[model samples]
Target: MDKNNNAVELRNVEMHFNMNKEKLYSLKEYFIKFMKRELRFERFIALQDISFDIKKGDVFGILGLNGSGKSTTLKLISGILSPTKGQIKTYGTIAPLIELGAGFDMDLTARENIYLNGSVLGYSKRYMDERFDDIVEFSEMQDFLDTPMKNYSSGMVARVGFAIATMTTPDILIVDEILSVGDFHFQQKCEERINKMIDGGTTVIIVSHSIDQIERLCKNCVWLENGKIKMIGDAKEVCDAYKKS
Candidate 1:
């Protein structure tokens, strides 16, 4: 942990998208010489006036309904997507498990894809080398290690992806609803590993629609509604409010 307690900060961040609306004209209408503007555009706001700070060793939970900009907020923090407005500053090395199969090659074997994905996540060949056996064991992928990833089941793919993404320790860990992919046993393993990371002073940000997970795992919480901050406070309180609403 650094001298500053806050590991991540979002200052009035906002993101918006331009949606185009097209007008339909029938052949009869066109023949009658009745025409209008072909295209109209509307600005859709995905995140509005979102501000929060996450401290090192904090298990921060982001809870919201679908399309509430939970994933967008995680992406903005991880540098996967830039915010359209406001500012964000984060310290320390961040490991993000945002999307499964985001970087894996379908044609490559599981073993080969692991190395490729590791490199994409900023791990060197030697680093992967040191952790290779442990990753395979944790993923329970030993049987299909040499098989092409496309041949594996969806669960298998997620296991391998999760194992590779989390093999190396990080100063900050960001998870965007990835625990829903794996089976119950694997989810338990992931939770145990995440708890270990938290114990070791790694800042964790969990974005999930599962209010139970948020309440169980997070010490602090934030709720987002229609791209705006709804609540920020104790995990139990925010979850109770979300459930009631």
Candidate 2:
């Protein structure tokens, strides 16, 4: 890697989706049209020629309205979904807390699910074992550790999920709409943990509509509109621009 290269980079990336054309053709014509028309399927553009870079230790905030592709942008960065065109590069490990309980198995007990979630985040079983107590204490699920995750309440599940996602100190952390999940006290604790990670030089990318939280937590921000870059600068300036319009 070049000395000046960023930790995260996107070079003119684009993402698009194709709609089904099954209903548009007859049974016999379907076979005939499948080979010819499938290549020309109707395209819906989700991201358009987007490009950005984040250096090490940069707390990058993504601010956009609903359907502005904020979540999709995070997905791209985390490698959950690939861009149709262009290039995306990340130097270090990424921990994406994109959705609450995303990798969880409802049928599994909380203790078992801890191992599963940690594995999904790229940690070995031994590593999870070492951090097991910290995870359980942070989640406050000591009483329900043996219970199946499906039996837990939404708030309880959020606690476990958030704790599992943050078990390992990742080099890059991507959070999407996670701050509004748990109770006020839990939210405060999570915020403190995230701040500690940032202080330790972790690159953080936050996708949220809460202008106040973004302003308080982020130093730099990017505004995305209609799958394109709208603004990129200081957090307050970009957030103020987003709130007014």
Candidate 3:
């Protein structure tokens, strides 16, 4: 692929999380130790030497087991987390459906959350005003729009989240295990919308545990194991190797 055609470029990316050596039971204990400068931390490396390129309009799959850094990679690409070492460059606008309800206030009504979440995603009030009805229609939560989001079930929240995130077609869409939350029917609807976005030339990076889903949706795949790239190639080839391992 041509370098200029790439939507995302990650070069030797490394992420490190600093974990406390000892867990403090309370704020008082934590503050006491902090004043004394006796607190100790252990560094945990989540990803190491990760390098990959996702071309514009490419449907890319990030495959890995639990704690293998797949979600971390998506977070990095979404600009939610920065690499401890190396460089990450993204070419265009991004819509991230990483954590459902993450941008919402549980106390707020679903209708209120539409504007709130839209703002978080960088959409202007005027833009949201124009798309509000469409968002409500797509989510199928018109009746519950006035109700507090905390009262809605997980599936309902997922529906609203997916609807709001996909309200506008972004240049790059990042999905992390969101399809696993909703019911089968809603999942299908979400898939169809995603397919429409993909057909419109939106680059998508999806992190899914389901090999079947990855194979069906993604053309290119990357397998991450123990924070390192194990394989990167055709989706079917990588998924087949992952299943065998």
Candidate 4:
């Protein structure tokens, strides 16, 4: 495929995590083990030679069971983590809603967090100032603006995160199951916003346990199992196969 036409490309990607074999209670004990060369590690593979391509303006879904490395893949694409092996190339700016409230300060009010999260997402203070009202409106949390995020419910937090992340249309949007936290009505609102972004030419990568949602929003889907690609192709076909299995 043409490079310019693709929004994301992953080639032979692999992710490995090292698990410590022993726990030390203190720095002194940890130093003793290091001096003795007694530190041991076990390697766990999270993704194995995974390869895929997402074209510009496409809504792609990653379907997998728990521990299937779907979240790992998204982290790699978002540059939150590096793959142990292989290359990932992305075109355009990214807005990641992978972890709700990851950029929030619990002690800060919701009003304060909007700018905080906006800065983390690469927007300047002046830019966030311009969009503050729009963000608050979309979040429907104007009443709670002065309330600390720590006091907000999970769903409320998710709403703020979603609002900030989608306040502007990015070239690529990555979402990871956060929509499930919202009530049915809010989820609908979010889905509509996502759909609008897609129509405006944003490429979206979503990881969801909801097969119905994957089929409804994604044109192409990949099924991951045991850190490998189990199936990839048209969303309906792949999802149907996964359902049967």
Q: Best candidate, TM-score-wise?
A: 4
* Residue-level lDDT tens digits of model 2 in 37-136: 5535678788898888888898989998898888888999999899999999998888889887888899999999999988887789999899999999
Report the Cα lDDT for residue 216, model 4: 95
Which segments of candidate 4 are over 4 A away from where they belong? 1-3
Model 3 TM-score (2 dp) = 0.93
Judging by TM-score, tell me the better candidate of 1 and 2.
2
Whole-model lDDT, model 1: 0.89
List residue ranges in candidate 2 displaced over 4 A.
21-40
Estimate every model's Cα lDDT from 0 to 1: 0.89, 0.89, 0.94, 0.93
Please list the residue runs of candidate 3 whose C-alpha ends up more than 4 Å from where it truly belongs after superposition.
1-3, 23-38
Once model 4 is optimally superposed onto the true structure by TM-score, how far is the C-alpha of residue 20 displaced, in angstroms?
Answer: 1.3
lDDT of 4 by residue, 28-123 (tens): 988988999988778999999999999999999999999999999999999999999999999999999988779999999998999999999899
**What clash count goes with each model?**
0, 0, 0, 0
Residue 1 lDDT (model 4): 50
Clashing pairs in 2: none
Clashing pairs in 3: none
Q: In terms of lDDT, which candidate is stronger, 2 or 3? A: 3
